[model samples]
Target: MARVPTDSPARRPFMTAVKVMLYAALLGLIGLAVAVSITYSQLPSYQTLTKTNDLGQTIRMRAANGQVLVSMGPSVGKWIPYDRIPQAMRSAMIAVEDKRFRSHIGVDPIGIARSAKVRLETGRFSQGGSTITQQLARNIFLTNSRTFGRKIKEAVVALALELKFSKNQILELYLNRVYFGGGAYGIDAASTRFFGHGAERLSLGEAAIIAGLVKAPSNYSPTADVEAARGRSSVVLQSMVNNGFVSADVAAGVSPAEVKIQKMTRQNNVRYFTDWALPQLDTLIDETSEPIDVWTTLDPTMQVAADQAIGRNTPGGAQGALVALDRDGAVRAMVGGRDYVDSIYNRSTQAQRQPGSAFKLFVYLAALESGMKPTDTLVDEPVTINGWSPRNSTRTNLGPVSLREAFARSINTISAKIGQQLGFSTIADMARRFGITGEISTYPSMVLGTSDVRLIDMTRAFASVSNRGVAVMPYGIRKVVSANGRVLYQHDAAEERVLVAPWVAAEMTDLLQSAVLTGTGRAAQIGRPVAGKTGTTSSNKDGWFIGFSSGITTGVWMGRDDARAIAGLQGGTAPARAFHDFMVKAVANRPVEQFETQVPMPDWQLEPGEEAWGAGDNAVEPVLDENGQPFDQDPYVYNPDATAPAPPDPNQQPPSQLPEVSVPPVRQQQPTDPSRRPAPAGSEPADDPSQSGADLAQ
Candidate 1:
């Protein structure tokens, strides 16, 4: 009775279970093989991982003087080799993320168990269990998707990386490619973005804060909330202490206030210019793995001045944009809005708003091109074409006026008549030749700027005139250099494009100068020989002022994004005033420039031809109010006690030749080099922030 038979019922049941398990194992292997076959093309090649591990090139946009305007791309600030990466930054990351990083092959079972236990005790996940190598594998060759297949890929890739690379190489890869926060990918960029310096200079406390951000970048972003970020930093420091990376006293020595949080708004404003400039890179160079330096035409001084002008002078609730271009078409300063934070939709480049009177420049240029002189007699009377009638703001037209006088006065009837005579297609072609882009519709009322245009295009068109009729396409990039400072592409300014005859620009200048001196653009006069035109559309939905002096052309536009009317807003008030303010600061340090040998302002048109060309009772247009609407009564009368400068005396004669603008008292700033910048508080001498972009070029 003691011996059990080998083929008993219990043994048979065990054998059946073994067969079922074998079949399940076979099916699982078959399923895995099928999965591999289906997804092989999408999966990264593990053997090629080492060769393709080059970190993403960080695109650093810098002003002319090398002040970094903004940075974008896969990686942050700069690439740091494992050796150059500050010891504290590496230590803090290891202590907080994977204490057993040195001993683990690819995964850390001990760390995972610790994390799971802590989760059970706290009823919440308190720590990450993935080793630094696993993270590097995910960052380098895998997506962040959470799935069984993705996890398997991460593990397999991590093992392959550990086999091919050392602990330091894995750490360096992780540090350089990890996403920190706020558009920053690596330590270098995150450090500069948050602390205004490079990662190499991070202090103990700063390193701790950066290490803490991996868990929740947005929540711990110092820019968004400093106190919360400081709390996270403390936790990182305490973890470092527990892991023996730092002593308890040394950990406590790091102060919370030592973390200086720079506001992102001020620095982020330049993104408007960078955003406009970045897309142009696609046309300039093909995408490459090596980093590149985009040396833009941005002048730091001019940029600051332009920003101040728009911020201070733009009418509240109405947005304003400014674009300044050198005669050669290099963009000096671009402020795309009153505040970029309020709107990222670039008003200078993206917004296709009605140019209003600004488009009149195109009309006048076409008029001059068509053999019409500034002195040609043009009647400022009512005119209608295709049942479309044009009337001046005064609603009454002058009996007879010189082309110069009509232009200066911004008389609507004369421009409409000229557009009809010149043909809308002629004006449209003229605009295109002057580098105006996008659809410039050949509508009857296009002469008065009914067709929409970008401020940059308008500015570029004006720049052609400023360049003595030589054509210019407004450009922001001056040169794109390699990370090693090798020039990739440079703008060939010598390849001149003559859009208009020199004589035509001269005639246009004379008319534009008189407009500032004795017509609608009176507010634009800044004690300089300014030449500009004022544009105001029906219902005053948009206002624009574009002009050029000292070989630098600037255009300003004011309007709402919704195309709603800004009460009384006109080119002569806020837009012109902003232009005046920017110019006052922009050209303060540059030498005064001559307008070439141009024709004189017309005094005979006022007196000698008084009978034929009516001696208008109003020599200059009335001063517009804040919203740019005309004053009912002539209110520009001289007031000695006025805080504002009194209006020019109508009885007094203007000079035969326009005078060059006198320099103001403002001081120009040298281009900033962050490498030369004094080390900020709690920072050390490491890689220069200015050189970070160049350093990461590879």
Candidate 2:
């Protein structure tokens, strides 16, 4: 009877359907095997992963004062033995991430079914399909890709991990390798980054907050948002109550605010410094499967000063960067842009711009090295090299002026003449000697700093001058140590290369002094005999003030990122003022430093029949009496009988000149002190701003 009905109308269709189901089920099993085999083949070698550090590499950066700046990467936090792990942290982890973490082999089938049912009922997933073991497996051996293939691989690896390691071992790996917010990896790092302590010391509240972060670290990170983190913690607490990890009364007692989080000062603009420095590990050490602690030369105080200075002084819609270096070229402070949130591009080390008159340092150093004295007279006239005619910013032809006079006044004509005399190759070589490693154009215009240069490089070059001629290599990392306290790298303090002769540095410092004392950098004056130069490129596209005070060389650059000009912006204005503000605080604790050995710089006399070029925006010549004489002399001392000039115009601007033309400020007024005056003239007048305001560094 059974055989007769086997092929009947109803039975025939059922028999075919059973055959098809069998084939499909067989194919599905085969596909599952292939996926498992492929995932196992692609898995990283885990024999070395006996402990928390087996899978990740972390980098921890600190300031000179041992202040932890940032701890990032897979293994950033502390790694304690299994017994040392906090019970509260373990309870919180199990409560939120996988309540059945201890009982499940790897993937939690019941949890997945429950979550799927919730998703169907509520139109949203209330729990993740993956368990803690699956997450550990994915984080260790897979990517976060949400594709079905990745999910298959995740499950396969989770089973492998559960089979290979004990229940406690799997939990240890999962707890230590999970990602927390703010560059923290592992429960220890998350605890340290958020609570400023190791995971072993985490309280119930702190542990719960951290456990909640596993769902969406960035969205619920306390460091990223306050209310969002609190909200997420509330959810985690309810999860603990639901999972029976804690009673509802116990969960209710856990207040998010009761958990003390560390101050967030480390998350500021100093990230610019860390971002620049982290990549250096490639050269400093061999690849390792452990975290590293990098103690840097960053000075927290100086970093703050630099940030505030740039923020307060940078013009609206423009960006500014400041790099301060020790005399030996250790970077102390760096501000890459106006704000890190607005942009991550590090202008200090990445953006290359013309330094304008600041580039004159190379030409003059080359000149001095070639035996040309600061007192040597050079004609400030139209001179063309390779079809490039160099003109002063003031456009007033300063006939013949001494080297000191031309340099202090930022005389583009004389600087170009010096560049011509020494040859562009010679100037470029000098720049290289002083730590400018980038491509320097040897073109005639390059003599006037037409070639691009990084702000960090310029600051380092000037550091050589302040270091008394020793060459500088601007560096951030001072020491690197592994997690096991093995010394991986350390800065060489014995290496010192001379970039210039002491006499040459002294001579350059003398000219720089004249610039602040009598020329375009008067705004940088800080009630002391500081030396620096001001630079403004054509159309005021780039403004620079690189100077040395108390052995600290700071280079400041302010301009639009697109290289457009800011109206009324000059090196002597925003950049110089920022420099002043930074340096004043930077050197406040340090004793005043003077150029130890200065080459006797003469008050170079103007050539006969040629009057002194009036000071531009950079100078404050001594006020002279009612003589009403056209300013013709360098008055180093204040003149008693000079008229008390009216307060300068608030909107006073540097005399606008054509592009590529450099000039000394032609306006002369008494500078109660210069540059603080809007007219570029002061009560204790220098010469015309045409002489003082000259800038070809644009």
Candidate 3:
């Protein structure tokens, strides 16, 4: 070939190429310098990888005595210091990820060139060529996008990290802050999550397996794919031997199969209570960044008893809920459902079901407030209003009964009459004032609990009666403190007067006691002078029994979500049995206390044809009308043997010609309805008719 002249066309192109190459190299060096300076200037000051009391951490709940109830957070594991990490894990990680980890400043130029060559030849970017320091930089400060600008920035940031921190510091940060999959955030968490032990106690095989996970944690997780994880660990061991971290003999001898993986066992029933209390945390805690210790008012003993009670009495396929509160309205225990695992819906505070007769307490409270004495008498005959005729569960009338007796029998007619006399609006308003925020019907049947209300609200309302008329807002958290023992929040119960008069509550309590002693709630009596009411909804859908002693107020409910009537279930039966069992255990250690003495009052105002009677010679005189006969005692009577008496139809009788009569002394009588008799053990009635007298609530 002819020699080309240095200044010829071909020679000029070659010289141009050489000059271009040199200029490009110079420009690259200048760009790298600028990038390094910028990345170094942007680096953060030294900060520990593990944050203690970081408000950003998960919330923690504890009992009143400082026992941990639950810790709610993304990172639930403890932080382990760098020195505590095992040497085997460190060697395994360094060998598998970057053999030149200690020797390289931050970016490994030789490895980068090799990775770049491989990518070009294979048409794939499988080789990352990332040193431990570069990975630490990307994990803490950079994003994982494969772009020229990001890579440049990553290189610069990695250099900055290497300059600012020692190799050991960089490695320490890498192992302590990297994600190990399965919500395990650090080496300690990863060790425990995979091996069921601490990082400091990891074996050689365990260390190799964990180190293998760094490349692709989800795919290499031993818990998820054992064979794949073992294969990756085998690769890691070979890499360790190649890097001189371990001898080939030692690497070959190590077996990933021998690594014992632990199954996570976190069976906690308190999650239900914690979930219920979560909303309160935002208002109760202003600083959630640092770990806060919430001190709640849960009585562990009462909680256990409540759990066991529901489990024992609740039949299969039937769901139940229970709530217990102290005299001051502190929620001692709450069972939202039969099993929280099956469902997280908290029935106690969230579910709104018809309270049935349980809501009658508010009605009687209204009646008591209206000067209706418990001893006042009313006819339990069927009454109709606007065409809604409420019937007694017995389908027959109790000729005459005392207000106290009527309540004990849960006579549907009497409650409907009382609700009519008071007016539905009056009863609805009174129920609202008592903390029942659920929608209440204004119909006459409202007295029979036609409105749906939450169990917590009912418990709160009854607790107000137990608290001597002072309204109570149910609270679980007693106090909140920081991890460093600084007081963050404290509960100071605000005083409230829900009832108009304290005496009204006392009188109502007396009436409730009478119900428990000889009325529908007789099955709920625990022999220590108890008071409460029984409620059953229409169609036997829901049953409830709420009662309270001098110190604790409890409410129990049993039903199915499908609104299917549980076979043979009644408010005064299964629910009452649960209440008795729970209360028996809850108050076993507490001293028995007497209720406040109820002050006596004069007779209540009478309705039409109603009168007060005295047993002694001090009886009042009889009042007579223009005619010489007693009212409701006139000679004209409806004989059952004949067809039902036809009223001189309103259209036939002249208003002025209606017969006038004289009233005579009325005598007290026992209820003729057999269902009015107190229910015996195992003979409880359904909330629907034919169950029992108290079953008429709905």
TM-score of each: 0.58, 0.59, 0.60
Candidate 2 C-alpha lDDT tens digits along 403-507: 777788777777777777778899999888877878887777776666788999898888888777887778899999888899999998758777777878887
Q: Could you give me the TM-score of model 3 versus the true structure?
A: 0.60
Model 3, residue 520: displacement in angstroms? 1.8
Quote the positional error of residue 321 for candidate 2 in Å.
Answer: 0.4
The regions of model 1 sitting more than 4 angstroms off are 1-54, 71-268, 597-698
User: Model 2: how far is 87 from its true place, Å?
Assistant: 32
lDDT of 1 at 691: 20
Comparing 1 with 2 on TM-score, the higher-scoring candidate is 2
**1 or 2, which is superior by lDDT?**
2
Candidates by TM-score, descending order: 3, 2, 1
Our tally of clashes for model 3 stands at: 9
**Model 3 — which ten-residue stretch has the worst lDDT?**
634-643
| CA shift of 491, model 2, Å | 2.4
